[model samples]
Target: MTAHEDPDEDIPTGLDAAVTVKVAGVDQQRRHAELVKEIDDAQEAYYGRDKPFITDALYDELMLELQKLEAEYPSLRTPDSPTQRVGAPQEETDFSPLTHPSQMLSLDDVFSIDELKEWMTRTEAALGHTPEWLCEVKIDGLAIDLQYVNGRLQTAATRGDGRVGENITPNARTIKAIPQRLRPDPAQDFLALFEARGEVFVPLKEFAAYNDKLADQGKPQFANPRNAAAGSLRQKDPRVTAQRPLSSICHGLGVADGLAVTRQSDAYAVMKAWGLPISPYNKVVHSLDEVLDFITYYGQHRHDLIHQIDGIVVKVDSFAEQQQLGVTSRAPRWAIAFKYPPEEVNTRLLDIRVKVGRTGRVTPYGVMEPVQVAGSVVSSATLHNAYEVERKGVLIGDMVVLRKAGDVIPEIVGPVVEMRTGAERPFVMPTHCPSCGTKLASEKESDKDIRCPNSKSCPAQLRERLFSLAARSAFDIEALGYQGADAILRAGVLDNEAQLFNLTPEQLVTVPFYTRGATPRELKEPALVPPPGIRDGRVLSANGRRLLENLRTARHQPLWRVLVALSIRHVGPTAARALAARFGSMDAIRAAGVEELADTDGVGLIIAEAVRDWFTVDWHLEILNAWAADGVSMADEKSARPAQTLRGLTVVVTGSLQDFTRDSAKAAITDRGGKAAGSVSRHTDYVVVGENAGSKQARAEQLGVPMLDEAQFRELLEHGPTPASETPASETPAPETPAPETSAPTTRASGAPGTPPETRDRRS
Candidate 1:
């Protein structure tokens, strides 16, 4: 069991006779047997060995189910069951053991907001009154108990089975955060014996850097910070632990004699005075509302902190109240951990499948048993390429770790090796394209990405390109989505996107899927009949008409948008805009040499080469000619420029703006000749912050750069910044505080249409 695996906490609510369950039958008995075997195997792997075969979420779910079964049928309860033990016994024979002075316990964990509220309410009722709560970040790290005798350090141990633990005093001494001797006051007598409880961890940034270093050295990297810290501290040689930059934060007390502290917060202050590390984020809250606020604040800013925190630990502040509430068999009744939704989860890898992208590059993705993670349900994750699949060591039918951070794409971290059964089979990359039978080969000699060389005629590639053309960043065609693109190609309406604008209602009516109240699948049904309101034998659907309308409107959508729709490799909006600004016309861009194209600002050598090569392809140029013949504008018309009020200034806009889309916001700044930078720096003149504006806002504050809200940003856009002498000091916003209308943003690169700014190009 991991740190948060105490049975008292792991059991889901209403499993304790509050809700009725069907009586256990043969099916329940078989399920109970399966659950016990799985839970026992997981605990043995995690505690007995140091490898975890399953995620904390999976383990909790198993435990919940097991407890529910046991609750429903008392006959199934066994003394050797996982729920009956504090933790699996320590099996590390190399390390000497030491019995702890007192039992070190795990805190009860609550997952949802309602569960947290219920725990708080139950605690208040038991205490007879509301007690002050001490809230602190529950760091995701290994728990340790440091024993001190007569103001001097003695021994340090892990919380192995609570009563006894592995002796790691030599390795513990290597950590600078652990004080060797207590700083006693001359005016008062210090406790002769004291036990300091803390969580040992590695800083998030340092851990990432260290992982990179390890990868560079051709060494296997640790999976996470918690695992890194645990492995670093458990080294047989103390010098090995010394080499690792392990840090710790003291949180609770184990055993203290003659301590005069009346509250947990006071104990932390006393511990800090004694040179013990305590969390800077620890706070004393007088009410449940304040506790909830603290949780909410940390939940939003969890990534901004130095270390990883999985949850918030809320404890009864007063020692008297805590003592009265006392302890459960495995955890302290006075404290509970409000766990956030998991960012990483374990699920069965059902199969590995390959997908062909617009460029014909083949990427493998894992099909998983759908699991909820990071506030969403994800069933598939991209593996990038064949090499990535091999490197991750994931086999079909194995349980794999899936991670999704906020709104980012979900990815399979790696496979759990210990859980692999003999039935698992390694994935083999296909030699031929799945959609169109074309032999796959690397685009360049050194390129790891394999592609179908038949890019022009490959149905998969053409379909993907059509979808890209209709994306928001390209033609912004809403009606011609994936389904429409696939339907058009399958119905032989168009062989490729070259004839996208040539589509007519008469041609669309022939494709049953595009006709009113008729589907391609149902068209073959002999008894199937079309819905009412048909003009002739068939009529174009609303979506079909809308597609034609959108296609017409897309014809004049600026020269840059056309460049984006052409599917030129590396020629995204940023490079397209640069080319448009310099060349002005498609004819000039086609006639320009690679050196001239590369000379354009923001258009690098790679993008220039892609553009020069694209014009050389006879088929690519044929599409351009076809679109131009269909009345699509190939050149941008000259127009008067906006007032250059912000000519020399560089501004960064972050978060969602009510009046502007991400691209429109950038246009607003660039129209006035101001530089719209993605990231914040000391050179940034202003940072326009909007709703949910994340890390860019934080970086602006760190660099002491001024921030403006949507309203102030409008003022700045209309007229340049007011001089210091002209503006009143009282009216100015402090560098620390963003404007009242906007909250701080995160490090998330870019958001959806009404979301944050881009750290990278806002490409489809």
Candidate 2:
């Protein structure tokens, strides 16, 4: 008879109280089976469907409960439990173990900066010097060792606990990136046999597309890129693996026969010569500071990468140095993984507060207990709008999961509903605006967002508008951020976005921003600062003067920027550029009607209606007239270089520079008909790096991509790409490079009489 034969039994002591309650009427052994079933169902939904019914927090809790139950009642434990496995589900397999010539050891992982620094300190002690480190992006995918025998591909095996790995050679051959034969290189050691280690992964951009295909075929989709790659590579049939998108990045070695490489860098060089794929994000640095810089850079730009990386592997660059550092029982001491802050974390939702945007669009976000996510402390996250808040079913006092990917804004994913104590209450959006107390209005019953109609009077709206005007994507104005904009709006020195043109240094100093709602997100500013940041009674601070000059210097901004500054609904930088290019000036765009403007390329019906409505608004007209009266010219200007110089090219701009701000540098690239990308990729044409340049620069260096300093970048702007001896550009393109969506051209009608007839040229 089974231990679960009894219908009723005492509750397990080691299990969570909640779990005990969940299995109240069931027997103890039966409860263990129930827990397993529930956890497996959640995992299937998460991994197989790619659409999870429960949040990760809830899943983790359930998993914990199952583990506890199994631990306390060993008789109830089952071998088929989810906790006992790592790989995806199998159909049929003749899989057998393959012994490696040398152990495919794992690197010890360190989570925090302190721990990573401690590892570095210990490593330095071991070497009696700060050894040069080879930093490689730790791909979030299955590790594999590829064996090359007699200059031909022999076998591929998984990294199973560093000893014997499962042979998956047939499935590996399906990956196009894994070279079938090694390229002959005279410079490389004449090795007849060797094994190179690498990661097999599904690119992030392709992961979504692949998921869509699976969904269309009525098959469950994989949760993440890593899952997709692993599941695909483990298929019983090689043809199935081939049908799935899989890529490889060879990094290091496991075993070699008659090899004479002395340095890790040299080995990588030989690998590259032998036509093996390598990560462009890996580099060698002499100092620990540079290694940290690489980590920091990747942390900020991880989202920009096509493949996912949980952390970076810092390995001793010299084989001799690696030998001196030695290895532990399960891991190598010469290498350590400095993990990036996890993008997702668990925290308590204390409250939800509404944030009024520039257009009077109010969004309620959760006020979370401060938690570290993505290397930064996040106290609040956007719940989108009131409708979204209700849909997610999150409530106050609920333990919730939050996520912040790369440099993206932190967001509340959802609540751990199972952990709820019933004290949690559903949030209700107030009928009136939080900032101005104006009656809220929603255009339609289906509308997810509620807006404040009193756009002219709301302090929050005005402040946000000013901030938007100076935002990097809009105007490229330096030193005019939200804080400075809020200061000006609060002091009444800036009544409209256009008043920026008329502001004086004397008038600017009195700007005061009274903390409106006092949400926890506002950590830097105090409740009431009469003069912006000033604590003491002062009319004009020195810091305030510098801001005033920046505002003054913003007068010469281009027409496209002016259009963006106007903050027309549905009109962003791309739309503004299209409008400006088509009309040649703001006057023409303003004079055109909704019907005529709708005909313009890239100017759809929605944008056309928004622009027409904005022009017709009494307050908007007043602001435009004010700017015109202030002699803020609406003239269209042309760049010195031909617009097609960088046409169809993608560029990455990074770090602080003496000559140009981050925005201006990006603007320079865009104005020349190039795409200013946030991250580095195989398709990137140039990486313009400045002082304190982050991971993109390091990645570019690793990929052998062309890099231009400020001077060289300016030179390129003047005379175009030089020869290899002068400027070296990488020829290699990345796997699964995303082809940008191509919008078909629509011929535009010439707007109202007296408008410029020239067609717009906003390609990207």
Candidate 3:
């Protein structure tokens, strides 16, 4: 009988109409069974193998449909139904036999803040003490198990189905942060077999860059960094993995034969020292108050950090305590991941406004009634692109769900369809630039990213350009902040970025002052400093004279600084540096062919086109040339002699150095052709550890890597390169130490190379 027909409608006797209907019901049942099998297979491939062919939304929809079918037809439900469980069965593995001494388990998810708080309360009640919580960034990436045998690297495996994992030792070794060998610690005699569990992830900026490069080369891009990292690690060739910016941070420890650590913090320190990257933001809090404070702090400042963190992992500090706490069937009892709820708020979409950015990209922003979300009052949220607006079906005067994903920026998640009234108006992407009234154009083959054809003379674009020029990293112009620039703009004295040079003391005297939270007030005319080679009745001191000189000289600042100051979309400080380093001069860069520009390392087609488009505008070229003509110095004349002693070596400096500040210590490494990385690794040739050095020193010992005290580090500097044979053994003699009280001189030479004179003066 067909599945749609009632089973009791007819008996299979002598050619009756009801019997034929029942036969139709039987056919429908067979079709439903086939669909269930198909879905189950797909689920197995996705969750079990970590290789999903279908989109998450599609998979979810299919599973929901399957669930509904099973509910409707109880007899169709099977033991292996997708709706019955959280994950699929583990795939068979062929790797060498290895057993986890302490079984690694998955986390039990608590979706909301209230749930997390409840979990904490329950744990405290069970323990009979306020457990010290160590909060760490919950990185959304691939989990890997690293095993170190006798202080040496042995194996690395993917967390496949909790019980077993795919062996990825070669790929793991290519990750520069992972240690190849453990430092020898005489104090810890039992640490022979050590296992560290962590997530491997790509930083957001690097991932974006990688995707951009892929697009430029006409290759498909991954959806997100997590997927990118996973795919890269799973590649058969280790060399491919090395090219990706895959980094790992140890969040928990597993079985260790040689280690005698009693606490989670000690394990973290050991992991960090051994050169496996541990989260820099990891903190140990003795009280629940401190734990909440850390969560709040990280939640607010999440965007500023490099990597993407979805939530914080809070774990019990004591290993013995953790052992006693033990595990449930699925998750560890000692720990729980405290997830910050998705930053989404229900708000009425009042209106839609189009904004033209500095790069002339037209973005649709939603004007909303003020709503408090994640401790901030947000009045507006970004619509991202025309496609997003249409996909979300966002409409004017509609109640919409606004979200700030990763705390990056507020964006309209979707419109609330259930609450929609007939008054809601559909939004259409604009055909003209909102700022300059130029025609908006879209690249037909690419995603819908609307752009203004007016490359220059846009008021909004110019304001951003000027702001970029006056930013702290660019010109070190203390007087020209956002408010100051706005005041300048409001005075009706300046129309473009170039008009700033034409301003006089009389013009400046008319500028208004607006205190942060107060009404605007007329400034009590402070005595002004005249520009260089121009004198007015402005009272000037030595410092004032210096400031004016610096301001005039800023016009000729380095090409890289100028590029950064322009605030091009998708271009950051690192990209600007790469551009400047390659081109050497602005004129050469502007004149270069598009393909040639694209061929430059780190400069993709999009950025290359952006650079070309920026320079194509006559006014932009005129302004740059005007600055050059007005005596801005764009080149560095002095070059430091290369120190061959430290070439290609990675060094870590910890604690206070005798002859240098932290910055200077880093500079010393750079000046000597070595990289001063923040953490220790097997690749690290030396660790310049100072007095009161804690975690890093311990790690260096565990890896059997040689550590240098401040005096020994200084000796290495003075004596030139130490040969492999001449290199001190692990038990080398200590050197003469300097007095702790002696403060090092803050000389100009000690400053960071290429730092502007204005910044150096401010530091002094």
Candidate 4:
């Protein structure tokens, strides 16, 4: 019998024995030893190693032949048959229960290129016109559903049995690419909430590295990346899942609310605009021919990619058309998977090397003899970290099995242990930083990494700093980018931050926007001078400049942005804002003792120390002084105006009020003469609580702070600002008098404290 025949009828008494079966064409061995070995070997390679023993075309052919043999001889079919299962069962773990918004479904298979072409022809015939197709890589990993509410991440779940799934919210949050908040745009209303579905998986190389680490730890290693990722995701403890390297790309929508999207491409664009992580490889094609072209292109270039993708998924672009086409009990009729053949190749490991990032984190990489995987020749693959090298027991000159998983990302699956010649050399991590000549310092808290502590002087750090300063979010000098910065640095025109502002237009043009455009014969050089009517575009017009200059002449500006621009260690925008609001001004913050700074709300010892260290630095102090000399304000200019009305009186404002936010009302109080404090306390002179006032108003009553309704407060604000001489002293008391039994303290409660007892009583 052929190796593809089913072997289930006659039970083999021994492992090497064959069983007999009858097919339509002939009687054959039901359990051929060679066929079983081939199946086992292929499974081990495909599932355990992420490397296929044969191409998809060959594998599918064998599977089809086996199925045909089993169909004819039903008695020969076994429960262990590969065709009987969709995927391997999950390993035991603690996972939360989840219900899918919509049912998950599997796609029907199309075996050959001929079959794919035929399916396309039939689809076109039914649709009338050649419907546009969106070609996307079919990611090989666990499918998941993500839900967002009011632009905030709410929950995430895994796909299980196409109907229900397991909740995996916490695990999903660790992915940096998936934004927690949707960024708004002026042109479109941000989606308030929506459900998006995608696949999450570790890249093949990352999976190997992960497994290698586990092996080094003397823990059981997963056979393949997909299995490992699936197992990791199902862990009851989300922290464990978070530690695993995982990434996702949204390819489909589950549910959407308060938003209208017509086309699939538009949906992708909207998702990206909202800061959702969508696949960058999606393409909208005009016809089936274009779809085929994309498939060919991806197949030919897959090895250079990072993630694992099995095939191309083509779908009708228009939502309406998709609806018209409808769906089967399983998959959508408008969509079909155009899979590529699997790629597995043999290559030799020449050496393994470690590379360092800007952050000084060391990562291991492999250098190998060039071998074709998918359609490209690959010479190297990432080994991830030091832990991976020791775990895999990989060595130089080892004969290894390599693969292009999901037709992307070349990976070294394992060594051919039986063929080891004992000539392989062990790999070790470098003792010094690769980018800089500094000694590497291993992390004290974790053995996962070693870093270079010389951040200020590191060449990599300097390059990153220059790039960050010129980024769109920072100073936004569009003409200056990576290439421009590098050229300027090479020319020694910019060695430090202060030198950037000194660059003249003459010096700038000489740096060259384009070498061809500046060639001597091509264009005549003109006498260098600053552009007419512009010394620097940053300067405002005469009147505006005068106003700005006057504002800068004052002591302060809003402190948040100034702190953010400093780029202190471990301090981001949010932390900077919090620090600025608490500290008030740069001078006040700098003058405060370290203990006092640390005692401020939200300012811990670490942050306080950082702040102190920053001020202590001579260069930092010089920069700040120079900025001050150049008329840059570092305190809140708006808060420094003369006290107008309630100056010295502390008040707390709360709840929804007419025509004003709480902040504006508080500003109004400060603008008039009062100090607006956030919380109600015994020291507060008044609590201005509006409609829908809640616990704060109750707390004010309990604390005996005087409370005011919106109208009364407005009246007091409007008429209370007059000079004391305008009021005539009387035995009867003023219109703004407090009630006799109120008991709450008012401005006039402490008679003779400021105004005389008789005058206070008259005012009251």
Q: Quote each prediction's TM-score.
A: 0.77, 0.56, 0.47, 0.38
Rank by TM-score (best first): 1, 2, 3, 4
Flag the better candidate by lDDT, 1 or 2. Answer: 1
Write model 4 residue lDDT over 683-722, tens digit each, in one string.
7777776664543554555455666666656754665533
lDDT of 1 by residue, 262-323 (tens): 88888876776665766666778778778887787677767756678889999999999989
What are the clash counts of all predictions, listed in order? 6, 0, 30, 13
On a 0 to 100 scale, what is the lDDT of residue 163 in model 2? Answer: 80
The digit string of per-residue lDDT tens for model 2 on 1-764 reads 12221112233455554565465435776767777777655543332222347665777787788777766754454324544332122223335687877899888899888898898899899889988788877888899988877766667789987889988876776565666556677876547778999999987656767888876776555646777888887888665776677777777887775666888777876776666765555677888677777787666656655578899898989888898988989898988998877877789999998899988888898998999998799999998987667666689899987878867899887777779998998898889988889999985677878899999888889888888888766665666777877776767776777577787755665554322333343334544443343333433444555565665666667787888888888888766765665677788998898887887655789999999889888979888888778776576765532454565667788666788887677667666556678877777888877665544664665556687777777876666666632466454222221111111111211111111112111100
Q: What is the lDDT ranking, best to worst?
A: 1, 2, 3, 4
Report the Cα lDDT for residue 760, model 3.
Answer: 21
Stretches of model 1 off by over 4 angstroms after superposition: 1-94, 127-130, 184-189, 286-289, 512-539, 581-583, 640-649, 655-667, 670-678, 691-695, 719-764
Off by over 4 Å in 3: 1-342, 443-447, 476-478, 513-553, 567-571, 638-764
Count backbone overlaps in model 3. 30
lDDT (Cα, tens digit) per residue for candidate 3, span 1-764: 12211222222445554554464477656766676666645543332222345555666677677777766755454323444332221222224334554567998777667777888888888888887777776887899888877665667788877767877766676664465555444555436678889988886667877888876776655656777889888877665676777766677878875466778888776665454556555667776666676676666556534466677888888887887888988899888887666466689999998887767778899999998766578998888788767766778999987766654688776677779879999888888877778888874557578887666667767666666677755665656766666666776757776666555554554454311111122123322223321223223334333434457767756566677776665565545655665666776787898798887655689888878877777887777776666565554333423344565567788656778888667656654545677766677778777754534554455455677777677766665446532354366433322211101121221111111222221001
Superposed on all Cα atoms, model 2 deviates from the true structure by an RMSD in Å of 17.4
Q: Pick the candidate with the highest lDDT.
A: 1
Q: Cα deviation of 700 in candidate 3 (Å)?
A: 16
